[model samples]
Structure formats: C-alpha cells, structure tokens
Target: MTGATQRVADALRDAIEAGTYPPGGALPSSEDLAKAHGVAKVTAQKAVNQLAAEGYLTVVRRQPARVAEGPRRLSVVRDRKVYRDQIGYYFDQNAKPWGAIGTPTRGVATPPAHIADLLGTPRGRDVMTRTRLMAPKGSKVAHQVAISYIPVPVVAEVPAVGSSNTGPGGIYDRFEEHYGGPLEWRETVSARQSTSEEQTQLQIPANSSVLVVTREARIASGRTAVVVEVNETTMSAARFAVSYPIERDSSAGWSSTGGPRD
Candidate 1:
C-alpha cells in the first residue's frame, strides 16, 4: 500500500483532512487527478479506492468520489456517577445527545459463550436482548450499533426493560427504579477487524476496523445485571483522545499500581 499509489492517496487524504473536500463534497475526478499529477488514470483510481477503503472517501455513481463524514469523537473517562433519567453513558454521549434513536429491536436470545461467562450464566441461556442501530439526527448512515443483554432473571424483575419503549433514561433507569438501588457500571474497550455482520450493520468498507466495548452494570445487591457490547467503525486514529484518573500512593511502587477500581 505504498509507492506512487499511496503517495497520491496520502496527498488527497491530507487535503480531505484539512477540509479541502468536506463531507458530501466531491474530490477531483480520476482523469483530472491523473492529468494534474502526471500519473496513469488507473493509478489515480487506485488511490481513490484506497482512500475509500480507509474510510476517508466514498464513490458516487456517475460522479467523482466524495469525502466521507468523519466519525464523532467520544471521550472515555473514569467515572461511576449515574444520573436520574439518563440513558446509559455511551448511548447518551454518542447517540441520544445528537438525535432520536431508531426503534430498537427487542427480544430474547441465547447468549454467546463469552457473554454468558461475563453475566455469570450457563452457556446457551436465553437472555433479554435489545439491539439498536443509530444515526445522528440528520445523517443518512447509521454510525453506532449496540446490543445489550440482561440475564433472564434480571429481566423477570424489571420486565419494562424487555420492551423497546423502555422510556426516557432507558433501561438503566428502569433498573434503578424497579430493582431497588443505585446502579454502577464499568467498561472495557478493545478493537479488531470488523466481522462481516458488523460491516453490514455499520455500512463500512470491509477493510475498516472496529472498536468493541464491553460494559457491565451492577446493582446494589452486587450482582452483575447487564452486559452490553457496542461496535463502531474506527475513526481516524488521531481523532480520539482518552483520559483516566490515576490514584497515587507512595506505598505502592509505580509498577504495583493496579488497574482503575470502579
């Protein structure tokens, strides 16, 4: 992915990042780029294709490739505060704050082995599931995908959560209200190549990667009540900034400092 093709693509990417071609704005045609850069037309097309695969551009039929919209930057900070009438933090920050959520698909499904383990349930157990595909208010493309799972027992206690119309503040609010006590949450983040299913749901190029976040919610009774997995096409690596508070203790050497405690 280097040499002439990459050089040209890098130049165009830089221009796009600098806002020379904003989202929904078209870049120069391959013919124009070939003539301007003294390269073959095929080389120019390859460069454009590379940009598209990298999530920087998209093709328009009967027209030149257009600059793709950048991903919304989300800050992941260390905090355990729960607000009344608030949707889960990630949903609130990335989706609900900007627009209404598309109707979520609600039902019960068998949990995957890994999810079952996290929820402390036997494999193949049926669990309450809520899946959502969300786009910002005026955007045409969905930018976020989330699937939340609640053990069958937890669902029995808070039946309202099983419905798509879990009302304002969402399921977390219902948990606090019906389950008796404030809720606590912790999140673990990881990334990998997007699977075919993820590609289809996110409408991203096959070459693009995705960020996977695992969120766990615990009730006052100290039971892990919910586990949610969120997937999104990776934005430009340079775009996201993350911060976590560190507790300092002289008694423990720097090497001995444990991970953040929720």
Candidate 2:
C-alpha cells in the first residue's frame, strides 16, 4: 500500500475496530472516502481493496464496501484423511464427510513448474494429471479442488495406472506395485489469494484466501528416494481449519543446562 492509501486504510481500520462501523456495517463510498481522507479516489479504493484482501471488508460492485460479517469461524476441521488397501488414499475426513463434486477430469498434460520439480522432471514434459472438485456429501457447495500429477515414465512402466479407472486401490497402489516399495508422503502448506478462476470454481469471493497443501509421494529406490507424484489441494481459508498434531522428538526433553536436550 502507498502512503496515502495506508493512511486511509489505517483510519478506516481504527473506525471499524472502534465500532464506528461495526461488522456488516457499510462504509462511505470511494468518492466520499477520498474527499474525507483528502486522498484521490483511486487511493481510497486501494485502501478498501487492502482491507477486503485482509478479509476485514466485503467489496461488491455498485455497493458500499461493508465490514466483513465476522471473523472466520473456521469450524471445519481438516486433519485426518482416510486410506484403505482397496482404494489407496481417499476422501479427506472431518466432522462432515466430503466427496468428489462431479466426474474428475484426467488426461496427459504438463505439470506445474513446482510439481514438475518435485517429480524430478523438466517443465513442459508430458505427464498425467487428474483434477477433482470436492464438496461435502449431499451438498453442492465448493470445498476443495485437487490436482494430482504423475510422470509419464512412471505411467509407462505400469500403463494401467494411467487409465481412467485404475481399478481397485488407484494409482498409489499401482505405483507401489511397480516400484516394489511403499510410498512415503510429505505435505507443505501455504496461504495465498484465490485466483479469479479459483474464485469461480471454488465459489468464493474475489479477495478470499485459500489454504494450499502440496503433497509429494516418494518411494525408496536402491539407496536413494524418488518422487513419483505430487498432489496440490486447495481449500477456502474461511471455512476450514488446518489442524495437525505434532509429536515430540527425542531432543525435546529438558537438559540439565535448561534447554532442550539434543
């Protein structure tokens, strides 16, 4: 934010915090805000945009920017995901169950740059990808979208794995069979503004934030580990709480010196 925009934003934020403009309350129009703040209309708009991006305000065309209804409830707990020998890794579990919203899209395509890097493949290389939109069972509301990418070389070794229906156990089982090894999974989480396309697909607001989890599936090969697949999943930050339990390592114990023992 620019200096002028920051000033306007700070003032507006103070007013909101002071209950001058409570939650769900409307704020002045950009034109009025510009005049009041002695800043340009664009700067006032930028101020509103900044607050909207922070989830403090709701912005709609031809409407006065309003304070957000409330803080994120984050009611949905997203931690445990289920897996079975017959289906491999499947629908993620929470208090309420969710499933694929519709038929998944799958085909050969180039993986995203970071995904390709994780798969140890160069960008633009052909790979298989499956995209799925997921929502709670018996509901049409958007919950998450996942894209799973697999390298062509891995698929070539087990052609059936790339098929639309990978039979029982899905691709993970197939990959394990091909590698004669078990897969180890690791995930990294991040936060980012939802893209316009994601806003449409996920049915979220323009400035909504998303919790992004990128997971890599790797397997041991000889004395080295090889990344065979990577899956990227995104969910609305307002609706879901990402919770995970941390296990203490041996180094966590207190030492005679007072710090954790190594």
Candidate 3:
C-alpha cells in the first residue's frame, strides 16, 4: 500500500470513530472518496477493500458499503480480583466501557465456521447479528471493527434490538438486565488477516496487516450468551491490555538489624 492508502485509511478510521459515519451508516463510494481525497478511484477502492477485510465495513451484493457497530464503552483493569466461581478465578470488578458506539446495522449471514461451533448449533441457524466500528474515548481514530451474534431467541426477548441507536452500552448489558444474570465467563482468540470488507471499513492499504479477535461469553449457568468477532487493520492503531496479580514473599531473609551477616 502506498502512503496515499494509509492516508485514506486514517481518514476513514477517524470518521467511523467520531460517529461521522454512525453504525449502519453508508460510506461514500470509491469514486466519491477518490474525488474527496484527490486520489484515483482505484486507490480509493483499494483502501475501502482493506477496511472491509478488517471488519470495519461490510459490502453487500449490489448494495453500498456500511460502517460496522463496535463494542459499548466498557473497561477492564489489569490484575484485579473481581469474582470467583467453582474454581478459584480472579475477575475484574469494574469494566470501563471503550468509546466504541453501537448502531444497529443490516443483519448478515454468519460466515465463519467457528461461530457456529461456539453457538453449539448449525451454521445457518437463524442467529441474530450486528456489526460496529470501535472508537475509544479521547482518541481521534477508530481502531477496531466488531460483529456480534446471539440466538434469535435471546434477541427476541430484548425487543429493543433491530431498532434505535444505543450508545456505548452494548447488548451484553441489555441481556443481563432482561434475563437476570451477568456474563460470568468469556473466552477470546485472536489472529491476523485482511478480508475484502475490512479494507473498505478500515480503509487499509494493500498488504497492510490486520488483527482478528473472536470471543465467546456465557452466564454462570453455562449457557452461551454472545459471540463477538472483531477485525482491525493496523492503521486503526487499536490496543488492548490485560492484567494479573502475583504473590509476594515478605519473609525473604530480611534481618531486623542492619548489621552484616558474619
């Protein structure tokens, strides 16, 4: 990718992050973006393709591209013991919401095979899904793009979904409120790739790197609640942090007196 591509990617990332292109909002066409950026249509198309591959944008057949919805504002502190379960496990008591806004986008078919496995159901099971672009607070750029899937049954209970624009508070909170229990456990796996759709959403240059994070969450009763899949181009400059605690030994050969040992 040329510097122009990077420039385009950065510009688009900012737009998504800042709510310029709200979730489910359509992005300008390649020709329009090219004219806006003073670049060739090919360059604009390339940049858009990169964003789409990274999960920032989705391209529908014969339809214009759109911005994906991202995570609601939630923060996780490193190394804190928040909760315990059957096994001794430490959990974060407080989660700071990342500034990513959640706008309901047009529902799409589930593509990845792993998502079906997480749902413990068939790939074509009428699952409810949404996509978002994530822009953390105090940041000028949008770093990550995410898609979430839940059983249709789960979403039908909320009734507020598929309509209205909800800010940083994501579906997880809504599910807990309506269903009566918080998400107790989550598992995540990450990788790197460039999908056709991500290139458009992230506006990544050709050959630029991207990251994918797949996560699953469940309630204390062992029922699957949500599956989140994220794709982010390196240009978005998104970062994630994790923390844990270690025990300290206070009795390690420290003498009460300041005298040297004989």
For lDDT, the strongest prediction is: 2
lDDT of 3 by residue, 1-262 (tens): 8989878877886676545686788998888999999999989988888778777888787777898765132233434233543332333334233444445364746646667777665776666667766555544444566666666655566755444553334455565665577655444534455566666666554443454545565654346444322221122323233334565455444455974333
lDDT of each: 0.65, 0.79, 0.58
- For candidate 1, lDDT tens digit of each residue in 185-233? 7666666676676666665555556666566777665554444322222
lDDT of 2 by residue, 1-262 (tens): 7889988887886566434686798999999999999999999999999989878899999999999987443443335454553445653445335678879888888877888899999988989988888776654555788888888887787787678888777778888888899888888888899888777777676787889888898998789998878999887776666776565767677779988776
- Model 3: C-alpha RMSD to truth? 13.7
Q: Can you tell me which runs of candidate 3 are displaced by over 4 Å? A: 1-106, 137-141, 165-169, 220-262
Provide the lDDT at 108 for model 1.
80
Off by over 4 Å in 2: 1-68, 71-86, 90-92, 251-262
> What TM value does model 3 have?
0.48
TM for candidate 2 is: 0.65
Q: Which pairs in model 2 have colliding backbones?
A: none
| TM-score, candidate number 1 | 0.58
